[model samples]
Target: MRRFRPYLRGEGLILTGGMTALIAATIMKLLEPWPLKFVVDSVLRVEQPTDVATVIGLCAGALIAITALRAVFQFLATTVFSMVGGRVLTRVRSDLFAHVQRLSADFHEKSRAGDITLRLVGDVGMLKDTAVTATLPLLGNVLVLTGMIGIMLWLDWRLALVALVPLPLLWLATRRVTTRIGQASRAQRKREGAIAATAGEALAGMRAIQALGLEGAVSRMFRGANDRSLTDGIRAARLSAALERMVDAMVGIATAAILWFGAHAVISGRLTPGELLVFLTYLKNTFRPVREYAKYSGRLAKAAAAGDRVFDLLDQVPTIRDRPGATEAPAFRGQITFHDVHFAYDGGGAVLAGLDLTIPAGQRVAVTGPSGIGKSTLLTLLLRLRDPSGGRVVIDGTDIASVTLASLRRQISFVAQEPLLFSAPIAENIALGAGRDVTRAEIEDAARLADAHDFIAALPMGYDTVVAERGANFSAGQRQRLAIARAALRHAPLLMMDEPTAGLDSASEEAVARAIDALSADRTTLLVTHNLALAARMDRIIVLHDGRLAEDGSHAALLAKGGRYAALWRLQQGGRVRDAATG
Candidate 1:
């Protein structure tokens, strides 16, 4: 309820209107039986009537008017509830999506994409039906039931007692069944999420499954989850059906008891036949709410489970959020320093153990290390993807954590290995960055700088050509060049390239190397690569080994030192005798 309070903040008028309509409808329902009773006891039962046709006509007209009024109010109430429900849920869905997006990278690392989608799409959808059919209807019916029962007792207390005998038993039976259904419904909803996740995984990885010939394995996994979901759904349905039958039986028993007891009262002249008919009608009408409760119990249980899931998701606070008084960072000079930075994931072994390093503005540096030595961790820290456990990462002499994430990232242009390009026009892909508004000439100039304009122009639509998935339509070199073009257009002070020329053929590598050289000119660049040749070209080379800095100097200076950097370079170059002389 607290979770829903914000969404229902301004719904007072709609609820009031709906409540008024419900009361009017209930009054009309109570009056419906009176007209029939009057016809039976007065017009039809009179031995000497002055005008029989006129009396019958009046009674019939009154009955029709009451029925028509009830229908109108009922329609209004239903429409109001439906409108309120739809509007509230639309806001809820939008909020849920925005919250999910704001969550940290660490949360996404442990959570399944498909499960989140199910919560956003499936769980929220259940609340819609609950609001309309289960929630509002149950509330409205309770009020109607209370009013009708009072009228029943006033008509004849003894007959009302007979009618009420089976109610307590029915309530007890429904309570027990609904609890079990709720448990089953929760399990069923969880299994349905698993099924969705399995299908989504299979669809997204279908290419890999085909390549590895693992289709049968994936299919079997999906079947197991699908079967469990189906079993739980059927069990819930069966329990609901049983509860419905029990309510029907209780209704019948109450009806039978009232008929048997009330007939004697009327015959003995203790009650009029018209009054007896009214009491029976009230008894039936009072049970309408009970029957509704039994019928919607399963649906209500399902909605409760879904509501828990939705609120559970909404309750999760993002791990990385702006603190109070956090200020937006101004434009950076691109100077970077890691001051005794220590990082560990989930309290595991440290990836960076008390590492310290500094880079002056406008200096291009290359980072080289073996696999699992935290080469990529350095870039992530600079990007603020994850904060260090101990110490600060300062950019332009200000702690990055103290500044807004958007401001910090806007100044850095990153070109990741296997660069992600969307399915849009080539010009649009090139222009996508911190500030997306770019002129045509600016796009062409950036493309030319990255050595990509010639190939782009040779295409049928040139810059207007739409890329396929991640730019699979072009060669690897073309994709890398376009990524460089994108970074060039951003024109940020800092640029980070992770293995930009990796996994390419000789021709592709040469083309990408030229683009990297052009893009790095006069920029504050941090390059992570295993290519000794590329590292040799940087203004300075930093080598990381076993989560600590092992070497930092210009290529020639490191070679002269004959230290860790020299050994790595020699090993990659197969250590010629001429190279050994310099070492």
Candidate 2:
């Protein structure tokens, strides 16, 4: 919580004005008790009746003006306070998003995406209220309480001491209960985010769960998540209730004692009847801030919890951060060289073991391997998504590890097995890399190159049509082609695609292949695919077996070698399995 203080530190200027107005409001509120004393003493007991009437009229007018001014100052103070809180929120989110973007691929491999998203949206929103309302107003209340206590002691020390009897006990209870509430609130918020993450993941993967007939299993899991949140939330609420009841008892006891003691004093003539009435008025006014403070206690605790969660996200140092003094890369010449490259996801055993390979500039190479045999890992290394554990990957004779991520990513285009598109117009997705310079002609030409323009033109809004989230409205092939169109817009020197046509039918695959060929004309491209026929069409093939390079040569030469490549090709084509030596 102390570390979370930076979220409030940027509001120095706004807090200055707010504190001034809050002090003004507090002074006006303090005027309320004195006017009751004037009414009791001057109008009822004074000698000259007309003079008393005049004095009373002036006090009434003064009191009315002060009450109005109090409202104005309170509004101005809280408004500025909220503005400052809003400014901090902007900085918090901006930093959080930037950190998320810089986080390494390996971090993503281990963390659930839905959990990350919950931190971004749910946790961050909760922190905003803490600064805007809870913390600042708490300060104002403390000041009011302090000023009220001072005035009460000045009026009569004996009466003020009587009022102080229950103060320590109430303060002690507040301290203990608020601490409990804070811890409970933080735990509750985490559980709440976990529930959202669980629900989001379940909803996003609903089709998969249904297709696999796991509806009951997913339901039970969601129920468990919901129950965890409920349990934690109930604990937080229980603490808040205890705090309220304790505060209520303390206020009741203090007020009753003041009246009991003041009555006897009025009877004894040490305190006047008018003074006793004013004492009662001050006793009630004293609890105004106390009640306000108690009311906001739960909200403040909840907000503190949320602020920590958001700051946790903001504090997450990218696991794969750029080294200090990293240099920017120029255009990629695409001569990718991996020298004794070794890597892993969690610093465990190497996933890519002593890999060594070099593909010349403008070479179109297909990497074929078993599902988990590090083919994708190789592409990750080449793209600088994860730096190698043991060696360097150099592009254009420059080690990629030394370059800035922005420039390194700029030189290469990546299309995953499934294209990730937002729910936006097709033109925006296709020309995503063009930023502010995306033109109609450029978007169409890129679309045509990916063989996606004709189908796009057939849509209701042509390129302006909105695609559903993750391109759900379009067929798989259409999404892939649109992805290619986006990559084509980059027109980068290097391209890396993973199983680009794995899920397409023959007709769809035909369209996808033509688009890829057109899009990757002169670039150095690495295509990771299990389709041996697609591998055969590439200029060269590298067959990976068990995290090692098993074969590297032209497809025809590898077929002639009668190795694993030839065996896979034969098996895929429904031909006899050859008893080949290289296999």
Candidate 3:
């Protein structure tokens, strides 16, 4: 409720109007039984009564008017509440998405993409639907029940007490079953999330799955999750049904007891037949809320579980955020320093241990290392994607952590080994790097610089071409070129590439290498790669071993030293020579 308060405050006036209509409907319901009471006592049972037809006609007319007005109020209340609910949830979804985006990379790495997506889309949607259908109607029915119970007590307190005897029993039964139902519903929701995660993983890796001929294995995994979800769902349903049946039996027992007691009172002249009829009507109406709860128990239980998931995500504070008094960073000179930096993933050994390094402005450096070395960790620390467990990274004499993340990252351009392109126009994908409005001519210029303009222009839609998911529509070379073009558009002072041409063929590698050379000119560049041939082109090369700097010098200098770098170089050169001889 506290989480919702902020959003609900803006809808106060609209919510007030809805509540007004709800109250009016409750009053109309209270009046509805009175007309029938008048028809019974004043017209049907009266002896020597004048104008009986007029009296009966007036009662019927009043009944119709009350029913019509109640319907109108009910409609207003329902529509207004539904509209408010939709608007509130739309904002919530938008905010939740933004929050998810702001969370640190570590959170994303640990969580399944599909489970996070389910919370964002599926869980929030379920909450919105339940608010409109089950929650609002239940509120209205509760108001109706309260009014009817009050009227019943006013008509005959003893008879009203008799009718209320089964309420405590009903509550006990509801508590026991609803608790189990809620537990089952929560389990069912988790199972559903697992199913979604499995499906998303399979879809994203469909190419790999097919190539490996593992369709049967994947199907079995999916089936397991689906079956668990079905089992829990059925359990919840059964519990809800049992509760409803219990309520029905209790209502029946209470109604029978009331009829017996009220009939004796009427015969003894302690109550009028018309009053007894009204009491009976109120008794039935009073229990309507209980029946409604029983009916919506399954949905409400599921909604509760969904709400927990949604709010849990919303409540999570981003691990990475701007600090207090953090100001925008000035234009960077591209000088970087790692002062005794140390980092490790959660519950893992250090990936970077007491690493000290420095790069002068406008210097191009290459980082080469064995697999699982901390070469990439240096770049992530610079970008503040993951903070160091100890020590700090300084840029241009200022600690990067002292500046706003947006300001700090704005001066750096990054190109990953496998760049991710969204399902948008080619032009839009390139423009994302600009971080500002860009003209079509500028986009074309950047594309040309990356050697991608020729292929893009040859397409039927050119820059308007929509990329398929993960840029699957483009070849590896084409994707790399597009990524280079994006980085070119960024025009940042610092450029970083992580094996940007790792898996490319000779021709593709040559093209990508040329574009990278152009992009790296006049910028402070850090390239991480296993290719010693590419590293040889840089001004200097640094080799990492066992989370520490093993060798640092020019490629030729390190090779002449005959240390770790020489050993790695020899291993790679030997493999290439063998491949050439075999060919």
Best TM-score goes to which candidate? 3
Query: What does candidate 2's lDDT look like per residue over 431-527, in tens digits?
Result: 8955447789999999999999999999888989998987899999999999999999997899999999987876898899998898778999999
Q: Each prediction's TM-score against the native?
A: 0.89, 0.93, 0.96
Judge candidate 3 at residue 105 and give its lDDT: 94
lDDT of each: 0.87, 0.81, 0.90
Evaluate model 3: give its lDDT: 0.90
Scored by Cα lDDT, where does model 1 land?
Answer: 0.87
Specify the poorest-scoring 10-residue window by lDDT in model 3.
Answer: 40-49
**In candidate 3, which residue pairs clash?**
none
Tell me how many residue pairs clash in candidate 1: 0
Q: How far is candidate 3 from the true structure (C-alpha RMSD, Å)?
A: 1.9
Backbone clashes in model 2, listed as residue pairs: none
Candidate 3 lDDT, 1-583, residue by residue in tens: 5777798877999999999999999899888888888877787784836998888889889999999999999999999999998999889999999999998998888788899999999998998999989998889888888888887888788888889988888888888888999999999999998998999999999999999999999999999999999999999999888888888888788879988999999999988888988888888777778888888888998889988998888888878899999999999999999999899888888899999999999999999988878998888999999899999899999999999999999999999999979999999999999999999999999999999999999999999999999999998989999999999999899999999988887788888888888889999999999988788888899999878888999989999999988999999999879977986
| C-alpha RMSD by candidate, in order | 4.1, 3.7, 1.9
